[model samples]
Target chain A: MAEWVEACAAEDIDEEDVVRFDHAGRTYAIYRSPDDEFFVTDGLCTHEKVHLADGLVMDDIIECPKHNGRFNYKTGEAKGAPVCVNLKTYPARVEDGRVMVELD
Target chain B: MNETLPGMVIIGAGECGARAAFALREEGYAGPVTLIGAERHLPYERPPLSKDALAAEAPGIRTIAEADRFEAADIRLMLSCEVAAIDRAARAVRLGDGTALPYSRLLLATGARPRRLPPAEGSKHCLYLRTHDDAGEIARRLRPDARILIIGGGFIGLELAAAARLRGSAVTVLETQSRLLARAVPANIAEIVQAEHERQGVRVLLNAGILELGERGGAAVFRIDQPGNDAGSGPTEIEADTVIVGIGAVPNVELAEAAGLAVDNGICVDACLRTADRAIFAAGDCCSFPLEIYGGRRVRLEAWRNAQEQGALAARNMLETDEAHASVPWFWSDQYGLTLQIAGLPDEGAAVVRRDLGEGAFILFHLAADGRLVAASGIGPGNAVARDIRLAEMLIARRAAPAADKLAAAETKLKSLLAA
Candidate 1:
């Protein structure tokens, strides 16, 4: 695994906005919830692998606009029909006054 | 019938009917309520008929009884009386016998029946499954070594094949389409399922046609017409000791139609599951209402969850409050040790998203043109999709927006929950 990269500064997105960042040639959806919470997970719905970056993000939950399936952004757990898998989550941290994730 | 809304009366003691009764009580209606059932059993769960009852999947998958149970819930259960007619003018329902029950509100939860195969000249040994009693009979007559020929690769047919294989029977599934489960899943997605079932020793015949289902030497032999090549495109034949037909279902609509209610492929209903006649409400398989998912398209769903949830929602709206029917359609099927689940409703023109697949587990999501959730199917991942669908449905109620991040966390936890 590669060393963790400071992919994006914490201020890069709105609280409810989900932005895509790349590290180690992999894509991730870095979510900054409306409550100023920071979370990172594989940027896709686990069930159909639809990129979560393109899904509907609510409070702490994101719904795959594709099938309206949902997942908890914090734990990356998928909720809804046509989905029963979990989003791969990367441990998220707020360090150096910025959102930092150990993405290898 | 003229003055005040008649007391609510629900026909059929299935899960929908029972839930309607409970929901009415929950709705705080002080008027008289009655439940008429054709089956003698209390509103027992019917999903087991296709799964546990046939494969012995669970020790006691009996019908659920809440704390109020039947007695405590004050549900007037009328067992073994099939409603034969609905006198809409008089605001009364006529039973098979000479009894007529007058009601101010009537819920037609008269479910569906299996579609029979085309008739042949001679007698053919065929079987179909729907009710608990149907499952019981099939279970009793199931022979471990019997070879089974099943028509229709739909959920019910595939489920029965899975059960039959589990019970030590040789199973062969035939589908007229190029892929199995064509109606439920995208073609490419269905390929994965077909492959899985095949890996488990199921004989899957696709792009094959059946001239007829007839009896030959006491066995059901399906005459096949293959489509790919000259050699395979001729009239071929397959034989089995037992034949199971699952070509889909026809909604039981005689009573609803005869009652002068709006009837299409199923009983027509508005946002509140109300038929043309305001006095009647229909739920479960017998009715089709405007579904928000298919872009306000009217569709009929026969899955057990759709039956139960919609039935309850309709009940709650009809008796208790003036709430609209907002039940999101959901369904699950177990086949070849794989559990498939769905959330939302799907039609012909949706896009398919292939999520994940490992060791015969994965998911297929159906998305609409604008990417609004239309339908999804979880294989080995059904539980998550099922739950997310439910949660999304609630969000739809609030007409609120969803945070993509929260859904990701929920998705992460779902895998563990499903395994547990």
Candidate 2:
């Protein structure tokens, strides 16, 4: 079953940036797209388990800080070499100035 | 002569050669691809050998891709195989097993081997790390009661020291130069690294000259002279259970040289990573190619990212895509809780502007005489400076001339400057 959980304030993360959130002993990354839309995915890089929050976000893509592994955060698709495993994405929305992610 | 069709042949199976093999398939070259490796294991990542591989409870090889991935890609892997000579006239490489493999195009990614200390050769107490098996041997000696002595204060030596300290081993580092990472990083960054190592209970001796190295009572013993010591005091002797030599690496260019390819500090290649023979090319630590972004200055980088990028580039050029290598030079090292990242060549800078990111985290932006951004170096705990350093790399690639005031101000977004 999926449950909606409050992650952070909608304004906490800058536009075109990502922030890390921990809940129920699981790590997650919340992204605010350049258009102000919210998205969420597993926090660690699939390649090296590196924190995705430290990575740079350009549009919908996130580049790993350690090895430059790239992934499309919006669709959970790995972009290229050094990273073949795709990230797991979650349903995200903003309500009452709070970002909510559906976590199972 | 071999009966098999000669599609694409790669001479080495390290990160560079392995990546090139796959990259060829990705570029829609639906032809036969063969990757030959001297090692028995599959192609693995080397960066972890000095850090994570040493610190792990049960260290194992971190391969670039699994064996099944290779099978699915239809890439032929020839492991534990050595190419005896490159028969250029016949366009075939003769293997040590007396087999000849021909190729339409060839890539030499033989990489490099550790420079062995003359005195420590064949000594069981002295070890050098260049492969997975080497890391396993070093890990066995990193117990709590063990004493570790590291020679050379370069990235490999410093990282090993950090790993040893984490495992509760007593570690000491010796550097012939006045500072650590003298050739790779600036003095300011080197000081931070040295301090971090000291904080972790690692002894660092700079300007320490090695007098002799020998085994006594099954322990590695070293006699060293400290620069500030009295003349009559003589040399000080240090003993350790294990002595690791991380002096440096020499490119494996003998094969290329013997095949009549130009060899400078490394195998000489053009901007497109191709040798004088259009059918043959070289990449990774084995090849020294001109940097187009730096006005055709030739440099040989032994970095992970460089190897991957160059491998893919070589694959493209091998298929006659004719793409010049234009990426800026980038490197990173992690020790204790601090991470140091450098983008572009710092030596090219005529001046520097410092940017503070709070909590002892900062970045130094290097500018040329004409105020063009040349490099950016940052050191901080975790990934405090990763984003900015990445942005700085882009600016340097664009040859941007952002104002120093804007660069020094932490409030100014480096991404915004990219749009400008």
Candidate 3:
């Protein structure tokens, strides 16, 4: 069953930035792109299980804080070396002022 | 491809060498790739040896790639193997087992070995860490009732101290210098690290010289001398259940030098990581290459990222693509709950601007005499300083002259400074 969960207020995350959201014992990273679009992915980096929200976000890529493993938050594609596994992404939408993500 | 061609042969199967092997395949080279390692286990990460590996309930190797990955990539993974000689003229490497393998191109990634302390050479209670086996031995000795004495206050030593403390062992660090991390980090940041270790119950002794190291009563003992002591007081002795030497590492350049390759601090290589011989190249801790970002200054980096990047770069050059080594130097150390990160060479800076983040996190932006950002060092809890330090690394690579006020101001985003 698919369910929608409220992550945070859309304004909580700055443009081109990401925030961590926990729901039902699961961690997710909520990103606010420069164009005001919302995106979400698993909070932990696939490389070392580090929090992706603590990493730097530029454009659509999130660089891991520990080892600089890069991933495209929107598409969940690993950029290159040190990270060969892709991150799992979730569909995110802004409903009113709240950011909601679909969880399966 | 010629059936007789042996393809790409990598000498060392550590991070750099293994990465190079895979990189060669990734670059669409269909040639045969053989990766050789002296260690019994597959290529594993060395960084965690002093950190998580030590703190783990059961220590184990963190391999860079699994056996299946190597098999899938068609990389011939040879472990517990040793190369006796490099037949440069014949373009073949002779193994210790007397088997000779020919290669189209050879990579020397022999890496480095821990510098030995003469006095502790044969002491049963003294140990040095550089491999998975070494980490296992050290981990076993870090028991709750053990007294751990770490020699040298460098990154390896301090990290070991933190790990020992976490294991409930009483830890003490000895350094000949006046402060910890004097070689790389600024004193201010180093002080914070020392403070954290002290808070974690690890005793840090600076300006302490080791007169001798020997085993006494089945324990390691060190005779130390301090400058401020009375003249006739002589040297004092300290005993510990185990002693770990983290002094430094020396590049394994003997093989390269004997093979008639140019050797300075390490195997000398051009910007593209190729040695004087066109058919041979070196990277990682084994080679000292010119840094294009620092006006072609020749330097050898031992950091993990450097090893990985240089490995891939060497692979590209091996495939006939010319690419100069242009990345800024970056290093990080974690102790207790704090992490210290440094980007670029701090010695190049003539001025420093401080930027404070809340909760005791701050960054020191080092500027050259001409006002260009040369380096950035930060110490904080968790990943508090990673984002800015990374942005500062980009700025350093660009040789940006960011304004001091803007750099010192917390409100000014370092990412915006990148745009400027």
Tens-place lDDT digits, model 1, residues B262-350: 78899999878887777788998999888864457788888766776777778877763566766667666767655666666545325
- TM-score between predicted and true chain B, model 3: 0.97
Q: How displaced is residue B398 in candidate 3, in Å?
A: 1.1
lDDT of 2 by residue, B6-80 (tens): 889999999999999999999999888999999999999999999999996568889999999999888999999
TM accuracy, model 3? 0.97
- The reply for model 3, stretches above 4 Å from the true place, is B1-4, B228-235
Looking at chain B only, the TM-scores across the models are 0.86, 0.97, 0.97
* lDDT of model 2, residue B420: 100
Candidate number with the higher lDDT (1 or 2): 2
Which portions of model 1 miss their true places by more than 4 Å? A1-104, B1-6, B56-61, B66-68, B120-124, B233-235, B348-354, B357-360, B381-420
> Backbone collision count in every prediction?
58, 0, 0
Model 2: how far residue B253 lies from native, Å: 0.3
Residue B89's lDDT in candidate 3: 91
Give the per-residue Cα lDDT of candidate 3 at B296.
82
Question: Candidates sorted by DockQ, descending order?
Answer: 2, 3, 1
